[model samples]
Each structure stands twice: as structure tokens, then as C-alpha cells.
Target: VPRDIASRQAKNMCDEGRGVGPAIKERDPNGNERMMRRGVYLDFSEAIGRLGRDAVSARYGNLFEMYQRITGDDPYEVPMRIYPAVHYTMGGLWVDYDLESNVPGLYIAGEANFSDHGANRLGASALMQGLADGYFVLPDTMNDYLADMLRLGKVDPNAPEIAEAKRSVEERVARLMALRGSRSVDDFHMALGRIMWEYCGMERRDAGLRDAIKQIRALKEEFWRDARITGQADELNQALEKAGRLLDFFELAELMCIDALHRRESCGGHFRAESQTPEGEALRHDDEFLYVAAWEWGGENRPPILHKEDLVYKDIELKQRSYK
Candidate 1:
């Protein structure tokens, strides 16, 4: 089954209180991971009993062992609880056919660039694409670009463009450090994460998305004012690093919400709750909504401008994907 459909089902089940356990009783190493230690309990005990523990272990030994360790329950007898979580960032930096971005000399590949997988990624494809880019595609493509740049001959670090970029980063870091407010970096991050997860997660509704956009914008503003980043910018500070990244996440999450809010149809990972069939299947609006949304970040306080690359399939027939 496609994960988008499965995740939606899991979320919908949990929404209806049909979910086996309590919500987010625990978390994983990533910190964002939410576990209902008893998520949706899978009654695989019968399978274990029928197949024999040894037989089951032969195929899923690692999972069985990990599950046992986590819940302290034997898979042979108890139902194994599971929760759907983000394991992949399906889309990343936008890249062309050569895995190069709009910016000259800047190329992205693997899971970093938004390619192969438009929104929902399948198993092994991510690894396959990463390998293809690393071993074949990027090596050849990037070398071609670098061959031209060989003549630029070690540009001065003190050049105006370089100086401006450095100054911009310095100003932002100094601003963050100088804020020294009451709240910790984790505090703002957690708040932002919660808002994103709740409203702009696996499933999204129009109202929820609208509210999320508002909340995110407000959070971004409050973050600038109330965020407390400890230590100096010149040194290696993990907190500072986290704070800076989280600060970027704030902008990205807001844009994500805005994108989700406008897209009236459900497709891949961008499941708009407002647009779905009665059977809970994803709906697509090929006529109006079928286009690539390239969002241009219009500064810190300004609204983003969206440019659409209208999709026109000449040979391939455009059809709604059935995930039934």
C-alpha cells in the first residue's frame, strides 16, 4: 500500500479514537517522533503462533527484537502497536533534469533535490535515485559545470557578493544572539513543530491550514522577538546551529502551509482534507490545480510569490492515481 493512503487511514483512525493507544506517549531519537507506545495494535500473534516464533523471526527478526525491546512484549502473544511517522522528506530543493538548481554553480542531488519522487516516495526508489545521482548523473553533470568555472580562477573571498552574503549571515546571527529573551531555542522549536504537525501534517483541512498559516506567521514574528540563542556565532555551538536551522524551518513551514491551503485537491503527500472522495480516496483536479508551484520567498515579512509551471503531458495519459 502507498504510505500516503496508509498514513491518512492511521491518522483518521486515531482522530476517531479507534486508534489502539493514547497519543504520543513517547518519542524517538529525532525528538519529533511521536509514539503511542501502544499505537494501532496489530493482532499478529496468530501469525506468530501459526508460523512459529523461529519462522517469524527468520523474516522479521530485527523488527521483532526491536518491538520486544521497545514495549517489553513478546510478538508471539501480544498485538504489535504501530504508528505512522515521517520517514522521508519526499520533496527537497527544486532541481532541473541535470540535478542543478536555478542558481549557477549550485547543484542538488539524492533526497536533497525534489526529483524522482514528487511528493510521496516509495521503498528503495530513494536509495536507487541517490546512488544514480552519486555514481552516474551528478558526477558527469557537475564536472561539466566545474570545467567552465575552472577559468574564474579562485575568486576573492572579499568580493562584494561574498562580503554581502557573509554580512547578511553575521547580521542575522548577531540579531539572534542579542535577542536573549525569556524562552529557550527548544521552546520555540517545539511550539513550531507542534503547530506544523497538528495542522500541516499528513492530512490537512482548509480551516486547519488557514489557521496554521496564521499561527506560523505569528510564531515567526514572536520567534524574532522572544527567541533566546545562547553563546557566540564564531564558536561551534550546537544550540546556535539548532536555533538557526529552526529559524529557517519557521519560514519553510509557513510556505508549506500556504501551499497546502491553496491546493484544493489531495495528491500524494499533500492531502487536503477538503478535497477527497466519499470513500476517503484522494481527489485530483487536473484542470485547475495540475501545475508545479515554484514559490519565491519575498523577503522576511512579505508574502511569497508563486510561479506555476503548467503541466502538459503529450504522450502520457493524465489520469488520477487509484490507491484503493
Candidate 2:
């Protein structure tokens, strides 16, 4: 089965209380382990027995060693516990044919640009794209851009816009350091992750997305007002860096929920519960949502504006994909 189908199945198994394991509860990145179900087992005992231990070792010895080091379980003897977690994200900043974003001078390549894969990315394709982008595409396209830059001449570092941008960053750091509240950055981050995982991961719904947005706003307020930073901003401070990243994460997470809510159709990895086929397959509304949603960030106290770039297919025909 595909990773998406398998992941959903695993989630369903756990949700139905049919997941098997030691029922261990450990708290870390996976959220409150006590409240969440343990993962499904990836047993290899049968495989080892069938193929012989020697053959299995030859094929997967290094991977088994890594797994044993992490989980402290010998996969040769026992089943390994596994769960669905975020790995590869299919979409990113929109880019044109030359790999230039809407932002004129800025160019994106590799996984950062959402120009290659349509929705669900095929396995091992990203590596090829990444290679092509670095070794071939950028070398050719960037020359044209750089030639234009030569005509424009050198840019002054002391420009007003640059100073304002620097000031904005400094002010954000100052605000974070000024917080007198007690909660750590990790505390708020874990809470935010839990909310997103529950409401926006794997499956989504209209009501749940709305609720998530509300919860995220409340969390953001609490985070800004209360999240504590342990060290000075000028010196080496991991906590301070984390706090800054978390602030961005809060904004991005809220935006993600909003995007998911508005899209309304199930496409690729984004599976909306309200949009599905009679057989529980993803139901895509190509007519209504056949465009890239490019969101413009509105300033404080303003709503984000949606810019649609319609996808026009010319060379090939569109058809529903079947794995059966």
C-alpha cells in the first residue's frame, strides 16, 4: 500500500483501540503519550525466519542496527513499533518556469519550490529534481537574472528598507526578551503541535479547522505574553533562537489551518473529511480548485488576500488514479 493509505489505516487502527504494543507512555515530541495510543507494530520475525537470518542481515543490517540503537529492541527477535509522523511536505512557495518566485530578484530551487510535483510526490523524484535544479537549471536561469543585476549596479546595505528590516527583527527579539511570564518555549510549542496534529493532521474538517484557528490565536497570545527566554539575545542562546522560530511556527500553523479550511476539496496528501468518494477515497474538485492558492500576508489588523494562479494543462489529459 501507499504511504498515505497505510498511514491512515494505522491511525484508524489506533483510533479504534486495536493498536498493539507494551502500552508505554513517554512524553516528548509525539505529544502527551498518556493520552495518545501507541503505534502499530512492524514485525520482521516472519521475514527473518523465511529468508534466514543471514539473508535478512545482508539486506537490512544497518537499518536494524539504527532501529535497535533508538528503540533498544532487536527487530530480529521482536516487532518494531511505528507511527505516522510528518516527513515530506509536497507543497511550498510557488515559482514560475525559471524557478523565480513572484518576488522578482529571489529564486528558489529544490524542495523549496512547489513547481515540480503536482500533489503527491513520487518516491525518489525529489533527489532527481534537486540534482537537476542545482547542476543544470539554476546555472542557466540565474545568468539571465544576474545580467540584469549588473545593469542595476551595486545595492547599498545602508538603505532605509534594509535598516527598517533590521529594526523589525531587533524589536521582535526585544519583545521576546521582555516577557515576564513563566512558560518555556517548548511548553507552548508542544501544545501547538498537539493542536495541529489533532485537528489538521491526516484528516481535516470545517468545524475542526475553525476550532483550531481559535485555539491557535489563544495560544499565540499566551506565547507572546508569557513565553520566557533564558539568555541574552546578543550572545549564543539556543532558547532565544527557538523562541523566534516558535513565533514563526505559530503564524505558519494558523495560516495552514486557514488554507486547509478554505480549500474544501481532498487533493493529494490533504484529505478533507467532507470531500471523499463513496468508497472512502479522496474526492477532488478539479473544477473548483484547479488553481494554486497564493496567499499574500496582510499587515497587522488586516485579512490575508488570496491570489489564484490557474493551472492550464496542455500536453496531457487528466484522469482519476487507481492503485487497484
Candidate 3:
């Protein structure tokens, strides 16, 4: 409902100028600063007082294990170091009204497509949309698309283009194996993860995003040059599979920064610090950025080309939202 920007607000609170942590130091009626750490103090001791240890364990079994792992402190004794992180990505492959991607015959559904959530995702609604796609939408839409395909007849497996594509994949895997470097694939992955966490995590600014793009490009170069993987590709090779997945993540991370850099307006999860209000709320430039950004791969080592789909609302009228 709040356009999914609470994570940004949390990061903003920990900024250099306003390192307030989780506490809200609001002035009381008597003019004294009243510190309120909302959701900061999940008092296990209090909860245990109301409901015994067995009840607490039953209620928060997962969190209890997490508390032991993270801090090794009893949940009843100390509050967990709660922090916001990059959890669900509200973006993915672009899809049309029929949930079909630009690529012919390819259909995206649920979390695989970016159609449902937009730049923001609300809790219950997000799940509902995915359910709707699965049960109601995709069935009818896929049938419509498949009906046309039926007329075209069963596809030839030995088609030239299909064989070429298969060969391309084989060549890519062989290349990765042959061009083995000193550093392990895990090392590069960890480095890439750190870079993304530091520069492109919950909070993003222009300088950091720019630096991220540069760093990602450099890391991507080093990744291609110095990634190592053990074992043969034909066998059940987990490392090879991981390395391949990581290859996509590297490119995706770079494109993420590029897209972040391109969109100057602060809206929802894609918050640009330069476009936020003084009070730190995201400032949406609807006039300028009311469109979906789609990026296409433009060959190896080339920047992705962005194509926009204009958003035209038929039911809802545009209005500025404010919450105080």
C-alpha cells in the first residue's frame, strides 16, 4: 500500500546525517523525545511471560533457530539485530496482456514475469495476482497462443535454427570449461554478491549506482577472465550449473545498475536519493516516468538497449499520495 519503499526509509534512517537506527525519537506531549523502536524490540521475555517457553518455541520455531545461529543469544535475553535486506525482487521478464514475452512462444507466469507487481508489490495482492495468473489467466491465454501453434503443426526438433541454438549452448559450456582460471567460481560469486549488497542493495543513490555499474563491469570482466569450475559438463555437475546461473546474475546485476541509473525519479523500490523529498519520502515523477522499462541484450560486452512501454491508465486517475 505504501508503494514498497519502507526498506529505503529504513536505510535512510541509518544515513550519515540521520543515523537514528530503528528508534523513532518523536517528541512527546511534554516536549521530551520519546524513543519508540517499532518492531525493533520483539520482546521474547515478555512473550514468554505471557506464553511459556514451549508456546514461544511453537510460535517462533524458525526465528528461534535463526536467533541461535545469528547471535547465539537466547531470544528471551537479547533482541535480534533486525535489518532490512533484498528479499523478493518485484521485477523480472517483461510480459504483455496475455503473459507472453516478446520472444515468440515463450510465456511467463507468477514471479517469472514483471507484469503483476510493477515497481512496487503489496503483500496479499502480490500473492493474489500470482494465483490469478496460475488459475484464471494463463490457462485461457496459453490456450489462445497454443491454438495458433496447433495450426502450424508439431515443431521439428531437427530444425536448423534449433540445432544452431543447441550448438551455441554446447559451445558456451565448452568455452567455460576450457577457459578455466585460477580463482574458483564461488570466489567470483561472493565478490559479486558483496558488490551488489554494498552498492545496489536496499538503498541506492546516483554516485553509488554509478560506482556499482563501473564495479560490476570490472567484476564481469574479471569473472570471464578468472572463473574456475571443477568436473566435466556431461556428468551431474553442480558447480558448472552454478557457474552458468552466476553468468546470468552478473549480466543482470549490471543491467540493474544501468536501469537504476537511467531512471532518475524516486518511485517505490527504485528510490533515487536525488529525487526524494526533504522528509525522505520517495518523490514520484509520474509525468516523466510513468512507463515500464524493458532491456534487451545487445551482444557480448555491449550495453543493453532499453525499450519503454507507455502506461495508460483507464480506471484510476493520477493523484499525489501523502501520509503523515
Best by lDDT: 2
Tens-place lDDT per residue, model 1, 1-324, is: 566676777767775657776555533212355544335766777877798878888998899889899889987677777777766645677788889998987988777776775454666777777888899898899989999989889999889999999999998788877877788889878788778777888888998888888887787788778878888778988878988898789888888988888788888777787788776677898888878887888886899888887777899997777656
Model 1 regions more than 4 Å off = 1-6, 12-38, 45-62, 314-319
- How many Å off is the CA of 314 in candidate 1? 4.8
Cα lDDT tens digits for candidate 3, 194-301: 677666776678898888888777877887798888899899988898889988998898888888888888766776778877766778899998989989899997
- For all predicted structures, in order, the TM-scores are 0.85, 0.84, 0.77
Q: Pick the winner on lDDT between candidates 1 and 2.
A: 2
State how far residue 15 of model 2 sits from its true place (Å): 3.6
Better of 2 and 3 by lDDT: 2
lDDT of 2 by residue, 1-324 (tens): 557777888888977778876665545323446544668998888888799999999999999999999989999899888888976666777778888888897888887777775354556677767787899889999999999888987778999999999999999889888886899999898898978877888989999899999888898898877888898889999988999899789878888898999999988888899998766677889999999887778876466778898889999887765566
Each candidate's lDDT (Cα)? 0.78, 0.82, 0.76
* TM-score ranking, best first: 1, 2, 3
* lDDT of predicted model 3: 0.76
Check candidate 1 and list the clashing pairs.
none
Regions of model 2 farther than 4 Å from truth = 22-34, 42-78
In candidate 3, position 300 carries an lDDT of 90
